[model samples]
Target: MTARPPLWRDLRVIRAAAQVAALVAVGLLLYVLWFNLTNNLRRLGITTGFDFLDLPSGVNVADNPISPGAPLRRTLLVGIKNTFALVVVGIPLLTVIGVLVGVARLSTNWLVAKAAAIYVETLRNIPPLLVIFFVFFAVILQLPPPRTPLVFGGLVVSNLRITVPWVETGPGADLYGWALVGGLLVAGGVAWWRTRVYERTGRPHHRVLWAISILGVVAVAGWFLLDGPIRPSLPVVDGQRVSGGFSGLGAYYAMLSALVLYTASHVAEIVRGSILAVPKGQTEAALALALSPFQRLRHVILPQAMRIAIPPIISQYLNYTKNTSLGIAVGYAEITLIVFQAIGNGRPAPQSILLLMGAYLVFSLTISALVNYLNRRLRYVTN
Candidate 1:
C-alpha cells in the first residue's frame, strides 16, 4: 500500500487547524469588544460590579411590598418570584385552552371548527404587545373601581385588583405540608403499581382514579388529624382596598391574560399540526375497535401527537416567558421591569442588563432541559 500522507499534510490535520484558527479569531474579537466596553464605561464614571446588589432598592414593587431599605438582591428575588408565578399559572391554562381549540378545529361540526380557526388566526396574527395593551386598557381598566368592586361569592373584582378565596395555613401547617408530600409519594407509588399490573395482566388500568383516591383519602385524614392545618379565606373589601385571600394586581391579570391568549393561539396551531401528522390508520384502528371519539383521541391519537408537539411547545413556553418582559409596558413588576427601574434610579445599566439577560437565559435553559427530558422519555423505542 502507498505510504500514508504525512500528519502535517493530512486533511484531518488541516480541518483541525482551521477550527482552532476560527476559535482563536472569535475569542480575539470578543476580547476587543470587552476591552472597549470596559474602557467606555470607565470614562463615563460608571461602576462595573455586582456590589450594587447589596445596596437598597428604594423603588416600590406593585402587589409585592419590599421595605424601602431592602437590598437590591431582595428586590430581584421578588421580581423572579413574580415571573415564576406567571409561568406556573399560565402554562397549565394555556395547555388546556390550546388543546381544546386545536381539537375543536378538527371537529366535524362546521361552526366549532370555523370558530377555532378564526380564534387561532385572529390572535396569532396580532402583535403580542398589542394584545397586552388591549387587555390592560380595554378589558382590565374598564372594570369598576375598588369602591364599587364586583363581588361574587368569595371573589372580588375591580379595575384596581382582583381577589379570590384561598386556603389559609394555620398552626401545624408545616407538619401537614410534609404529610401531604408523603401522601403524594404514596399516591405515585400506587399509580406505578397499577401501571405495572396493567402491563402484566393486560387489564384496564384505572391508575388515575387510584392515584386520586389515595391522595384524597390521605389529604382528608391529614386535615382532621393535624387539627385543621388549613382553612379557606375569602376576599373581604376593606374600605378602598381588598384584604384577605389571594389578591392579584390588575397589571398581573392583564399580562397573564394577554400572554395566555396569544401563546395559546400558537400552541393551538402546533397541536393541530401534530395531530394531523399522526398516522390516519391509527384512528381507523381505534374506530374498528369500537372506541368512542373521546376514547380514540385519548388512547390512540393524543399520546402520539404529544410526542411530536412537545418540541415546538417548548419554544412557545420560552416565548411566553420572554414576552413577560413586555409587562413593563403595562407597569407589571416582572424582572425586566424591576431591572429597568433600578437602572433609572442610578444603578449601573450594564450590570443590571447583564443580570437581566442571565435571569432569562436561566429560565429558557431550565424549560428546555425539562422538555427535552420529557421528549426523551416519550420518544419511540424502535428496534
Candidate 2:
C-alpha cells in the first residue's frame, strides 16, 4: 500500500521489530541469570551437573527395595514409583468420596446435607499440612501397635504398618495380563457398539452390564486357560512384622488419607456447584417426563455437571499430587523426600532440586494432559 508505506515506517514493520527486541531482551535476561547462578555455584564449590545421578545414593528408601549401593537414578525411580502409587490409589477413592459427599450435600435429608456441609467446610478450611499431621499423629499413629495388629481376614492394620491381600504373580502372569487387557479392549468395543445401537434404535442398551460380563468371562477364562497365573496373597503378621501380601508404611496411609480427605472436600464443593449450575429448566423437563430422581440425575443432570466439574477436578488432582511432597514431614519416600535426602547426604543440591522439579513437572503435565483430553471428549459439541 503506497510502496508499503516505506517498510521502516510501516506499523507492521515497527510491531515486528518491537517483538524481536522484546524477545532478545528476555533471552539476555535469562542468560544473565543462568551465568550468575553458575558463577555463584562455582565459587561455592558445588557441582551443578547431573553426573551425580550415576553415583550410589548411599541410602535405603523405606517401603522400597533400593539398596544403598544403587545409583541415584534408581533411587529417584523408586521415589517416583512411590509418588505414583499414592496418586493412582488416592484419585479414584477421592472421586468416589467426593461424588458421594457432593450428592449428599444436596440430599433431601437435612442431616445428610448438614453433615456433608460440615465435612466440606471443616476439611477444606484446614491446611493440608495440618491434615497430614492430624492423620499421621492423631489417627494412624493412634492405631494399635504391630505386635497386636487389627486383623480382618486378609487385611492387617497397625500404627507401624498396614497390609492387605494382593495378587501374586506367577509364571505366565504377563501373558495372562496381556490377554485380560485384550479382553478389556473387546469389552470397550462392545460398549461402543451398544452405545451406537441405543442411539439408533432408542433401546435400553445396558452397555455397562454387557461390558462387565464380557470382561469377567474373558478374565475368568483366561485365568483357567493360563493355569491360574495369578493368585491372591493374604497378609500374614509375624510378631511386629508383616509378610505375604502388600504392605503399606504408616507414612503412606497418613499421606494418602490426608490428601484424599482434603482434596475430596474441594472436589465435593466443585461437584456440588457444578450440579447446581445446571439449568433448572432441564430438571423441570426431566420431571415432566416422569423420570425418577436417580434417573433424572443419571440421564439428565450428571452428564452435564461432570463436563463442568472435570476441569476444576483436574486442578485439585494436581494439587494433591504436589502436596504429596509433604510426605517428607511424615517420612514417606516420595520424590521430594528422596531429593532432600540426597542433598543432605552431600549430593549436589542444585542438580537434585532441578531433577526434583522436573519430576513433579512431568507428573503435573501428564495429569493435565490426560484430564484435558477427557474434558475435550466430554465437551458439548456446538454446531
lDDT of 2 at 187: 95
- TM, every model: 0.95, 0.92
Name the regions of candidate 1 deviating beyond 4 angstroms: 6-9, 194-207
Write candidate 2's Cα lDDT for 42-80 as tens digits: 999998888999999999888777899999999999999
Candidate that scores best on TM-score = 1
lDDT tens per residue, model 1, 55-173: 99987888776886999999999999999889989998998999899999999999999999999999999999999999999999999998899999999999889999998889989
For model 2, the superposed segments whose C-alpha errors exceed 4 Å read 1-10, 189-207
Quantify all predictions' global Cα lDDT against the true fold.
Answer: 0.94, 0.94
Clash count, candidate 2: 0
